[model samples]
Target: MEPYKYCDNRSHHEDSPSTKVEPTDCPKPVIIGLYGLPGSGKTARLAELKAELSNDEFAFYDGSAVIAAVTPGGLKALQNLTEEVKNNYRERAIAKIKQECYNTGKTAIVAGHFMFWPEDDENGWSVCTPGDLDTYTHILYLDVPAELIAKYRLNDNKRSRPNVSAPHLAKWQAFEKNELRHLCRHHDILFTLLSPPLASVSKVGFLIRDFRTHSEAYNKNAAERKMLEILAAGSGNVETVIVLDADKTLAQEDSGVLFWEHIRALSGAAEDSGPLKALFSSPLGYSYIAFRQATLLYEEVAENAEFEAYCQAVALKIRMHRDIVNLLHLVRGTRHVRAVVVTCGIRSVWEKVLEKEGLSSTVKVIGGGRLDDGLVVTPSVKAELANYLRIARNLYVFAFGDSPLDLEMLKAADQAVVVTGEEKTRSKSMEKKLAEEIGKNGFHPRQTVLPAFATPRMDTTRLPLVRLTDQNFLASVFARYKNLYVLHATDRPAAKLLMTPMRDASISGSALRKVHARAGFYLATELCTQIIGVEAYPVPHVQGHQADGYRLLHEEATLIVPLMRGGEPMAFGVNDAFPLAMFHHAKVPCDLQHEHLEDTATIILVDSVVNTGKSILQFVQHIRSLNATICIVVVAGVIHSQTISTSRIARALGRFDGLSFVALRLSDNQFTGRGTTDTGNRLFNSVHMA
Candidate 1:
């Protein structure tokens, strides 16, 4: 309901060079202004920027209060008094804001409609009189068309208030237009129009904030300094800084089983038939037996070979030192890296490990904790650690982590890493079902493994350029690449295909496509590309006895389709790809016929992106009713690293011989700060024009 609920004022400051006063030796706070009409998604942008800044050292203030104060009769007085007292309230509010900035060392962002005040003329002003414009340090005008604003207003649930009038909306629009143009011409303000969407507005604000605050800190390090130089030289579009946790991430952790085993041995239960096993196997049995005395007796042999083996496993399984070092080198060597470091961990351990491997100087460390207890860690704590590091010096925070505990940190970080642990925590059947659903939804799964220490690599490889004129190229690409097709899978096809293409064009397009095309093309030639619009019918296959060269009849080819925006146009490409294949159209109440096929028929599904393979997985389960041989092929334009690293796709893929993947591109580009073009938009326009 409150789609733009998070949008608000972040801060307020004077823009006059004379009024601009450097507070302290403390890093100058970055002041970014997010300007837009009321329904232009300014708040959502602010929220995202706030989330990113939460992990950095810089402070953020949504200048909503300033707007509220400046409103007619001031926000508080308007609530209690009539319109007559409004002007008096406005003057007081402005004074208070100026005083607050002077007294507290905090920057302010004021959000509200501002109007140009001609020096020579002061005339009839209805809503509120023109005030001094020198208060803001940076002015950003969110140039959104009035038509779009009207659409947003009509659709908005919260703004549908009885008190809001057409007159008020018109006045606000007129004031904003005049003020934005004035700021652009008169002040040294940075004005950016909202071209992409209001969703990306907050990112622009964050960029301004960083430029104002930490640009210098970023220049201190050699690599970062070089990056800054490159950026200054206009060699890059947007430079990204990635920060990651270095424990169970760059290094692997020995299975916690080993640690548990060690604890069991320490408690004197070293025997294979120890009470610990009983405790795990049957908690009730161990509790009822009162076997404490027997367990203690076993403690005498706790430090034996078994216990040592467990410790060795725990230690060795922890990510290899070489791997950690290699990862550090990889991140640092990448020209885009502004800064890289392990934010928090056992400082001594990290230092020792890095030093021994000669990687100590490669990155900075902000770790402090006793090694014995492992680090007392959480996402917020990591966020705080990043905050401290950022505050100590101006810096942007990009982070990577593996557990749910790292979620908060990920939310706070400008960029994030969701590292996958090497374990199948979810049920294998569930994983299989999910993968099938994802395939049916028209997305392919692409996996990325961190290169080995010895691998010679640093800079990312470029993708092969394809000047595709067909708008349906994405759907066509999906149809050709995706490997899995299940009858009645539960996800939309087009959304899946969009993922990889949107993320990393190179990895998914090249590495993934090569492997998938090789395996999937061998499976079948008569691929069935279905454009599920409103319905579909099942084709029956004839049962026959085995014979020499018994060509499989009605071998179900893969079904690949894309989930289109506004309309299901992606289905047409799928239909075009497989002319002879059966077609189905999907709508709210899906209606389709089903006929049982050979148990071994391969089905490859395709989609654009795989944010979460839940839909695709669910769909796979639906098609299982046909009892066809089910192998999945998933083709996605872009694939989030989390899906590949943490999701069930990787584990489930091993379950079937027929399963294969062909992604046009795949990488953790979502939060990796990697640059990627919006292929969906490009492809859509191409197809629309064609």
Candidate 2:
């Protein structure tokens, strides 16, 4: 079980520890709280992370040690203290950690607890300190199976333990995590769950290292110095650089616009408020020159609490362009593309936005007009910023933006792009200026028009908006994204090359279907086994506690959906391999009754052959409609490779999340299955009738 980062929206929401602090420009104190249930290996994980992060970059702390340092007599003295006294000591310990992290400028990873749950209790009470809740910015829970936790507790020689069942421990872990997630939400803490990794799982050390690296960009001088340090350490192989515009480019709405709108909404009752209202109505409000004035005035007039709340609210709502994010991810994946987000919006707000996306650690957010801002990014200065990345860093600059403000930066870039939104909802002024700039220059800078809606989860399209219903923006981007490694869109010819010999006119009846179906199942199961990997089984065994089950970690919930008739044979073979999987036979697209799909995590759609790939495409769409997060895999003995690569099926497959395909061979056959070549006819012994 690899450590999984929780999605931005949690099952629980609250406002507790984080409601008090203003979004400060001060070097954010990095305190990562390592939490878990008793016997859940919190100490072991802490030690491992500490050993891995042993450097000037990170500082390690033990909760008990902090308590001991402050309270004197440590655990011995604390034992005599009342629960209230103990909690006070815990708060003091957290304060000490905060000071150390702030002073040393090192990330602190502390081992702590959320609550103490005893056996036989239905609900455990939260013992988390207010200081702990407020100070720690990130919380990672060591999520282990209840049976394993029970086993570890029983095996422990550390202390006398109460008797508990696997179910009891499981319930306890669930309660703790639920309560902790709610607490983190209220406190504005980033909460994630990490399962104990199998031997094959990759290390989560990079997540920590990346997070540590991201926190430094808050300070401009420090961030600049670090960038220089990277250059000094890195090879001079970075030839291309991407310069990004913040507001309407990286994010959907302009941050400034969103902030002002939020303020107006907040002051709805006091709409007659003059000072803020006057700044907006005055000529200064419309110009970039007045940003500093407005912000400075805002600091004086707006309640610190209200302003900070709005910042948080706006930051959370700052919808990142998925296409752009995918582009960044593609760049990051290569590990060489130089990309920086240069914004004229509040640097802090953009920083918060980037941080929420888990990119602040790696991507630099440069801009500001606020009090603590060291470098401001505006239209006039954007070119200078591009020049620095191009000239000083000696990297080819590629600029992406959405407005006239980005004209200078775009002109300065080696390869410039104007990222536009659909005409209906996108900033028309920005789009108009971008079109004018392109016409004025007559250069080949790309204009990537994204989705019309602001909602990030909208299934509109992951690619740029194509305006026309026919063109797929995602596919178009792939065609242009030369760095992208895409499959040679036509697999049918290749599938034919491999499968033609296996399927001849002479090869008819169940023998042909069985051979093809078995081959499909073989390839499908192999892929499934590799991807979803096995987890530890606590069942009694003679050899060892672990087994190479050759099954998905989520084997029970893995659903095998077979297109009826021709698909059943291959699905049966797949079923033989993944015996724990639930089998659902579908005769048509509508036959995919999704009522039983709520608990399903993975759907394996099986067919003996895919000529046009229509059925497979339909099933994929139906499954995605039921559960957007479900992993869909298509298995076929032979798919017309050309159809998979060139058709809408290929494009559709690319858009869905976690969707995959496996085929024994790619076929070049364009013939419809009517006679001996018909897969369903052969399987049904209808070849004689043909």
Candidate 3:
């Protein structure tokens, strides 16, 4: 079997030594008491030593068993006893072990918790205080910091074990400060486990090796056999793995540079020099601000000048890097690999890149976007990738990144490959150096160089202006509807006087109904009714608490004219629930904005029922902008939530929010139950229409 494939039982026996007797002239049985704070990995070190020595011709018994035997009970009794009682128990246990070692001529490994001693000194080593020097041949102190031991204890999920708590942790800390000094001086071979000096795993391995070699029946190959056992046991059942980048490996630009550029762009300035120079002058310039500014600038200049074209060209240039394309392709092509592109870059740019390369079909791309604007990716790209890997068991993830920012992704991956671009680029070189540093510190994955590729310039200038206009239109729509509310108003004299009617009186209920029905009607009718005549206004409000930071709420308004009863309740409920709502008292006359009479504004016309829809049909006729962005007519009650074939209203609403209805109650007109003839009751009377 492969080294890693061996079961625990097999590995244990394979490493166990057959020889029984202690060698002549060998070192005396070293009853080394390995003492550290609970879960300073003391037990793990002991286990490693046992496995290593089992391969050597030695008989070793961990003093834990001796302590258990000497006590009234066993391990549980010693662990359950109070500190003072535990000390007495430990002393008695040590006495018994000393006698046994003297008689058996076999080495023993003792693990204990010792108090500090200030006066005792036998050798230059006085850092660790020893309780019973007569019993121990050498005291190997694994002196990890209290804080580190606490972390290991917490992560190990063994807090339920006896004496592993805050009080016990404090006791261990105090003992290390006062007792370790005396123990170090008396022991022949004292090994100190220093914190932050050696990697925890490496330190554990080292301690195990030291113990094996110092045993009476020392063997050179003991360490190797023990290491194999540990490795096999540790990695026996791993399934899925993910590898990710820490920096510009995924993003076209570094986060710092992106931020700097964003700030500069937000300040309304063109790059007189390079983005780097602008960023140097204004440190606050960042990619977010830059992208926002660029978007605004594109909107402004796209109409007449070459500026928009230039911006698009630059974006295309940055996004069309050959190395990125090849890497993405390789990941996509790999079996059992659901490739995901995660970056701190602007979503707009990456979306275009994915579309241009025809790779959008193969990979899911996540990038940065405005939070309030609703364009930002949700649940976070890193979190999404982690979720995907978790669901797809047996995955071997390979993450590639170039900077520290990609640490989360890299850590989440099963394996990581740091991609350092050309060394000629100082930025790339810096990334490589940082990756090297991280790798040295055992945080980074394997590194690889992504060779440069031939640049491909895609032209968007020749594409139809209609497409660009549509994009702008969609952007505007999303920005406007990031927050949606069904504003309600009644022309009841008091309410109308309190709030002026937003539109002219000529815009009637019928016109509003047409707008609502646009989603269900033909495309031409939708274009003519909702989008052309509906008016939008921005409402601002304040949000958040007093002590913390507050938010500036910018909400867009759409006039929702609901039919009485059912429609009115839903509209009012939605509007009343959300702040920053502006309900138009009545529909108003307005000139159509677009030549194509599409309903660009989102419209939801609500009603209680459509037994005949004679009222609804007439109402839809007055709508001018039929191509509205969203024309949804909602109701609190529907005869059929899924029966679109018979209900035109359901069919219409389905085109926008899909074929689904949010209703408080839904029932067919017919009654078949025992009390079917109670039609005179007011409550049940409305069931026919409903």
Candidate 4:
């Protein structure tokens, strides 16, 4: 693995400069330098690399060739000169390469050597001049094993060279790699060591290509293809995809803010002191993509070493949103979930951040650095990636984001989340916009708000905030609220006590009916008082005075309908809660005539259990057909949340504006039984009623 595979990068929220970067007038072409030992085969490698990365924009040249052509006697004359004379020629060679690349608008890759030393020497003096460090945007050293280079050197038929021992070869190789790497950093140049074979040379080629490319145009089909392969090959066998937006969505502060602040502190300048303002405040006005475009430009002029330090500094200070960090970790532990961080922020920054959190291997980050830094992760583009994962990759995608920029992506996901936080900390306009969007789409996303002072170091001993934004919450909200509530679930001791005996095969007769009545009464009263709500009314007190009291609005007109034998005990429980409310037992939907529902403001449908929801749906549908405007509440001991969520019965009931589902327990188990397990059969000690 590369030495920089992991770095301790940290930045603080308190450290920041109150300014913006000024812009530059014109940009320069990026130059990359390929360096290796004399016998390390740099020339052959460069040739192979050029062929592999066949782009018109890329131009390659030999360091000596530039000097030979510019000088009088070419490479032979320079070599014959004294050491001092060679130094001057080397400096001039670099200048010519830089000018040629600048003039032709090409990214140049110049093959060069850092220093020259004899076979007997323990250390080699570096020939890398200040001009070379200043001119090259990036420097990559081909670190072929000394043994491999030694073997190849022995068979070399090209140039005459001195023979060196294995230990001496190792020492010389170490000196060059270590010195060159430090020099590149000292000059703020991007440096990478390519340990050939363990890593492909083509990896560096792709990095260069991506640096110049934009993320907005990433190939969707290709990305899915890669994802599918990863899924099939993954240890956990990923089935669900969780897409998260970075910046304020996953972390406390925007990464862009932290990055600029670090830059200003490192450069010893006020944030607004330069042309950076002009660059960012241009036509796009510091939008995510615009900021990225500026980053690439800023990186071009920035000292490679200093910029990287700032990158690491900001990453070190990063404190991920506590809940989100935990959620991501949870997703990692679950073999079925594949988490993706899709951000419009700097890609390298997030890569470092996730790496620091120890989730880099499992979690993939899809982001960009510069505007044209390859694959713009726009809101629409984010959605495209998510939808593609679901439609083509066969992964169920759940997306979480903040701000209007994430709206499209949220809508494209199979499940979505709008992460919000304290008003003073989060985007107010975005929070409001997200709410409006959810209502407009009619598929409300689970909304999560982090508690005050939330940090990256979340407490795992307690319930995770992410748990509040899942299918269970969504279902419950939808069930209880016409606009929000879905299914209400409780694990109350009272409800559970009743449930134990109801599900027991040993329980039968009045004993089962008594448990059913008790559970129904508790659920009905809780729903009316807390969820469905009861109306306030004036009552006659014992002192012969009127006082404030609560009642179901129009209790005299309210009607309770039980679905025959199984629903009768629960219906009687409803009657006890609303003693004035009329009770009607019916086996078929037609038993409760239109006249029975007339003048009633609320209708309570009571049942012992609702498995598939077909029978209760039939009961409610008949009542709706008679009185379309009456409020309806369904109370049951047990009901499967999943059944009501996906069944057509739920949809048919959804047409009514006033509908509420209240149950003692919303369970996944749907038991079909007779004799002891069956509610009606167990209640009356009757034969199987199937």
| Best candidate, lDDT | 4
What lDDT does each candidate get? 0.40, 0.63, 0.40, 0.66
Using TM-score as the measure, which candidate wins? Answer: 4
lDDT tens digits, residues 1-690, model 3?
A: 111111112112332222223345554455666776656777777676666554343344555676677677787876786644555555556666655565565666767655322122221112122235545554455656656666786778754544345545655465463444333332333334434433345444454444434331221123223222322333234332333332355434443344335445666877555333433234223322233322222222222223323334435555444645654565344343345555544444555556678777655544433221222221234534543454333233446565544545565553455555555442533444443444232233344444433121111111001111233322221221011211122323432432222123333244433322321222112221222233334334355423332211222343444554334433554444322333332221111123212422334444434343333332332221123334433332232322333343332222232112333223455332222222111112343443
Off by over 4 Å in 4: 1-233, 273-281, 285-292, 301-307, 370-374, 452-690
lDDT of 1 by residue, 472-554 (tens): 22111112112232322213354344333333445433344333333223222222222121223444445554433322233
> Once all C-alphas are superposed, what RMSD does model 3 give against the true structure?
27.2
Candidate 2: list runs displaced more than 4 Å. 1-29, 49-59, 72-83, 101-106, 178-190, 196-211, 216-690
TM-score of 1: 0.25
Q: List model 4 lDDT by residue over 222-310, tens digit each.
A: 34554455566567555567788988887767776777776667678865634344444455443434434445444443444555566
Regions more than 4 Å wrong, model 1: 1-242, 250-321, 337-339, 346-352, 368-378, 381-399, 411-559, 564-577, 580-690
Model 4 scores what on Cα lDDT? 0.66
The alpha-carbon RMSD values of the candidates against the true structure, listed in the order shown, are: 25.9, 30.3, 27.2, 21.3
By TM-score, is 2 or 3 better? 2
